[model samples]
Target: MAIALNTKLAEGVQKAAAEAGLAVVNGQESAGFNGIPTEKYTLALVSAPEGHTFTLELSAGFDITAANIAPAVRAYLLESAKRLTNPRPDVFVTLGGLPVSFTNWQWPFHLSVSGADTYVVHGGATLEDGKTAADQYLKAKVSASMTVTFAEVVAAPEQPFAEGFIYNAVRKILDQGQMELTKSGGNRQVVPVTTRYYSAKQGKFIFNDTTAQQRADYLLSKIYWLSGVLGGGAPVWIADPRDAQYLNTTVEELKKTAESLAGEGILKLDPKFEYASSTEPLMAHHAEYEHHLQDALDFTRPTFNEEMRAGHTNM
Candidate 1:
């Protein structure tokens, strides 16, 4: 039998999800990284587009019954509804201009018992090259310090407060060439999570400083990697908040960029004008996108002088 869910948390989450045009398709008890009990919900958009019925997994291991926690959870669920409309909600783009798919995430944050003042969440991110073996992935441990947890993040180490920056920190690490997605045998890498990725002043997360052209290129590359390559030419949500946060831009700007691409015959917008499918013009740039992906992968790889380390060469 499954464990019982916290009444207040379940009610609030369901209410928030409904208000955001989502429905709780399923709910059940789940376990966390260390076998901690959790409440897991499968959320889906009520009016999801045909050929796309994206489901998002939301798991809570902390006490979310507090009034203060409600607002953050509400905001997260609302944003999640928007994000699920994305062609691939699980995939995130790195500043290296690569798209990586994150999955098998051990949801919610767990407090450290090693006398460390921190909380951590574990997950895996796979490079979506369409050619790499699925078993290869980057094992990531996202951590939050006690100071930032109380100061910027909510008092509780919940999904709503920690998920956004955790995702951004993974992208940041990839951009800085700090971590690499490897085969299954590799050890988990730590992605130090902090509020530096969050802007309390702006009331949002900040990952990269991108220009308009850069953003445009990112959208095009997203379409190429996700839709053209992985999604069977399906449409992708252009106004994704995750992308907005990653690019440090607004959803409206993303819409405008999509419209621009549509105007240029690079994209075909759906009737709603929010989602767009790649056109032949966009697909024709496959070689260019392949080149960009190769460049990004190379840039994210670290270089070391093996010969010098082996005493085969002088410093």
Candidate 2:
């Protein structure tokens, strides 16, 4: 079975190469009877440039099948195109006060065959050998030459706040019950709980059921506090005009501070703020809330709140 599959694969590759206007010849031939190649072939020849030509060998265990061979051949052709088009970059790393350079010229192309996944190997045993062989082959066939260069190291600027600060702040707000966290599952997975609030102001500013007037007051208080801490020019409110009652300072300064805090990773105060208008209404969004409550009941098995317990009794 294995030998037949191997033969079929070799024939498919040979046919595919022939159709692509390339001549492919078997590398391993039988010792007797007109030197015919063995069914378990080892090598092949393709028409390439004179001095740049290199051999590409694809080998598999005897259990290999024709389905396996087809994708391997396709991957080989694709890899060849990639090498010719966007040659891999050279990398440099520092170790012990010395700069070490390395080049990667080959990549593994994965394919699934007969419900089993397999990878097609490029070059020979090692990457260096593959690079040399591929470079030679490309040079002879297409006069292609690859350049070697040093890699640059880029350091990200340090942030002002600790890592996960925004995540922790959001989680803390959720825990405070400012918004509802409902979990629902589908598609063989549990979707992240949807965080819903009655108003967009609540969603963005992390406020509870405060009235719009109260929110405006709260904003003014925050601006004053921020101004004191930031050494008091006039207090600036970087809030939507519809939501703002007190605008003692220019919107430009508000935007400037917002941008600075966001860049320093201290806060994310941009378009997420614009999402305030789409806030879900309380009680009307009961289907999602019930789904989440049921999920909680099944998983945690905790005592229900009076409302939930009474509802269950009615049901």
Candidate 3:
């Protein structure tokens, strides 16, 4: 029986050896053995003289010729035994996904107010004002419109606007009650006024138009901001649905390329092997794997008696 050279099996062995703090080189490559280019030892698969089974061969004198061979070989054999308990014929590989970037820009706004409020200024009598006292105070104390940027909002780890920062700012300015004037028992008294007299038509406000069309417009503008910023501040051309059409098309093209390569006899794909599609969001995949790192000590630490027994047996 001819033992096939399984790339995945080799990769798994390499992974296990690396986890055990072993330096490994795949295939019979150049450079050096035991940090010396003059000496070399390569690991390969070989068949027995009777051709009954296959065995792993670490080239001539490898047992004592190569440094760190004992621990590496032990790790490889232990992992190989574990893999034999449960075998998978197919391999899962990840193809590249679209990249995104972000930028910031200021947006414009305009607002006005009209209302009435009674107040006592310098011990004067009650006065009827056309605009609420709070509106006048804000107009004179704050800028006509503040600069609003979306960079941080988009990059926030939590869902955008979930912190209530923007909403709080708007509420503080337009909804928070102000101390105005009121007449009680023929005497001017300062009382809390919770009503907002300003009507913002084209600017940020605590309470603006809540129509369906207005809400849709607001959502679409935020979407536009995300797309523009992520596209490096340049206009992005994207489909309306923004589905994974590009990924699907790329996968189809890759299948075609693989078929072409197989026809040229450069590679082969088993008849049982089939292409798999991913429905997971591209961004979610990035977030999932961003912090996934392997540590050698994590694998080397003694955890279970069975695993320790296996390691000792392999050694």
The numbered model that scores best in TM-score is 1
Query: Candidate 3 lDDT, tens digit per residue, 221-306?
Result: 22222222122222221111111111222223334443443354433333421221111232233332222211211222235576
Number of backbone-clashing residue pairs for each candidate, in the order shown: 0, 6, 1
Candidate 2 lDDT, tens digit per residue, 148-227?
11000101100111111112222223233222222221111111111231124432322133443443333322332222
Runs in model 1 lying further than 4 Å from the true structure? 1-6, 47-67, 135-151, 305-315
Worst 10 residues of 1 by lDDT: 49-58
For all candidates in order, the CA lDDT equals: 0.70, 0.27, 0.25
| Per-residue lDDT over 52-91 for candidate 1, one digit per residue giving the tens place of the 0 to 100 score | 3333334553445468776777777777776676667778
TM-score for each of the candidates: 0.83, 0.20, 0.15
- Lowest summed lDDT window (length 10), candidate 3: 89-98
The C-alpha RMSD in Å for every predicted model, in order, reads 3.7, 26.3, 32.7
| Model 3 residue 278 distance off true place after TM-score fit, in angstroms | 15
Using lDDT, rank the candidates from best to worst. 1, 2, 3
- Output the better candidate (1/3) by lDDT: 1
Question: Can you list the residue pairs that collide in candidate 1?
Answer: none
Which has the greatest lDDT? 1
